[model samples]
Target: GSFVLKAAHDAYVPAGQALGIDRDVFSKILDEKIAGHPNIEIVAEEVVSLDQVPRPTIVATGPLTSEPLAKSMAEHFGGDFLYFFDAIAPVIDADSIDMEKVWRADRWGKGTSDYINCPMEKELYYKFIDEVNGARKVEPKDFEKDTPFFEGCMPIEEIVRRGPETARFGCMSPKGLPYPETDKWPYAVVQLRQDNKAGTAYNIVGFQTKMAYGEQTRVFKMIPGLENAEFLKLGSIHRNLYINSPQKLRRDLSSRADEWLFFAGQITGVEGYFESTCTGLMVSMFLDAKLSGDEKPEFARETAFGSLLYAITEEEKENFQPTNINFGLFPPLTTDLDGKPFKGRDKKLKKQLICLRARLRARKVASYQN
Candidate 1:
């Protein structure tokens, strides 16, 4: 295909705006964006050793980092874990959900009715569990067999292996949410959170799996509301390598051992296209400031940029894992704009408040260089 410019939007994207770029199109646009820029060269070569890379450099080699470079990084940083297998959850067409079989509500009566609940009776939930346990899983690659799965992205089937009731206590728990159209809680439930601003798609929260795609399509459709569900993206598993940024990188995402060295993208342990791009953009800004002798500005924690940076740079050092930019990363709100304490029900206003605060702060994260 010839070079084409196209725009797309995704819920996972901060601010819900993105450009859908394929490889050829990406090359064309990158050339255009950096046209006539000084002191930049696009070198097409195999980066076998980090030692050979120039100073003031960034390593944004992404998930499928080359073996040699990964080796160099491990040896240089004295850190382990060349890789881990991660599973992604499926995204469903929101319109396909049988609204009659599912009801919208916030679990535990917290926040707005931000999740679509698929209620299942005891018989159905048990049957679904049996099917899930019996479904054919994707066989691991030779390299993936020894690699551990990230705890945060643990596949649902793997959880089931611990016990049939494990899921009942985990993601499929119905402890707080009552059954659809009734006060009595269902035996188990499936929750779908809005995955896009348009509400066109819903992600099956915490449903990452290693089930074969065909088995996934057949088994997942057994849930009450998703009988005719259209999967926008099917769950998948892959090997990924990311650094422990909180312990390894600095506030500006530069190396602690080498001020001139920087890291970005998935290598920094962020798990989305938007997060990776933000890491690169932010790193460039910080690197430019350091090299040019200007103070680097920081994003407010209220903003997605800051929240993501906070995740990679300042999150709990123990049991670190990659994650998409999410509202969970945002700081909790305690009061309304009037500075009064919020009522119990006002917790529903929390997301809107966070967005409002982020928008206000994002205006001041300037990018233009002197």
Candidate 2:
């Protein structure tokens, strides 16, 4: 019941290729293009109360969803709603960045040398670390209790707290990536990646921090590329709410008690932008079938969407945590490889195989839908 088989198949998609559904402007195009669908009507209105709307409708009031709606949702679901904190990294203006110290390269020169690397000497790196560790942390508001952060997106200071060198080994490690001029590796590296389509904004690559606004400005500029860095937005932390979906929701993404209401996006415990969008599509498909008097959409266990759904719907709830769409969630393939019974890197390859199977499965699903 895992989707690793599906993700394994998707592993070899060519670089720069887009997968899943085309979500960009297509969604608006869909709103216009399909505006004439007999059963479909897209309404542009905020529902202050779910009771005011029709029943059997979904309340996908995402993370920034309104308080009244959120409260109404909690009450309808009964018991307490689960929550987790999600963070957004600060955006930096491209023109303001000093290109002298920042070099663009993909680590090891992989596809699309798209990342901006800010090389750091040991002394300078330590100073940056000192400021990060000493920055003032904000106190979260009372309504944010259910929004504890997941380990993957923990702020830079939290990583620093683990050990002095934890961040270097993780986000800032300079191994394999070296400066061409000196043929020497930096002691640590700060990276920035373009945040939007126009490339006007870039985010501090691995520099998610909870530092106060004044301190974030004072500290982060110490890096080589950012001595005069102008910040479009400062980094800060906030709590997000989520449920342990594996224990709470089914593969159809419905709660145990209220099967009619489906969960989607980050709130369902799937991480990553694509993962959230895919869930929304899946929910749309599921609801589409229901509205058409057809059976609920049943995704093949071999698809990426299927794999992610399996992970969220199948893990132990108490121990279940948020997961991004990856091959690991797919079921292992029956490999003929004799070495070590298919583990480690071998397992990774198997995931690719599963993804291929998923692709084929998706083609079939598409054909059936058509």
Query: All candidates' TM-scores?
Result: 0.67, 0.82
- Stretches of candidate 1 off by over 4 Å are 1-6, 10-41, 88-125, 138-153, 159-207, 212-235, 332-335, 341-345, 367-370
Question: Per-residue alpha-carbon lDDT of model 1 for 70-129, expressed as tens digits?
Answer: 899887778874467889999899889999888877777766677788888888888888
In model 1, what lDDT does residue 160 have? Answer: 83
lDDT of 2 by residue, 210-316 (tens): 77888888888887878888899888776565666776677777767676777888878778766877888888788788778887776777788888887878766
RMSD of 1: 6.7
Q: Considering summed lDDT, which 10 consecutive residues are worst modelled in model 1? A: 1-10
lDDT of 2: 0.71
Candidate 2 segments exceeding 4 Å error: 1-44, 142-147, 333-351, 364-370
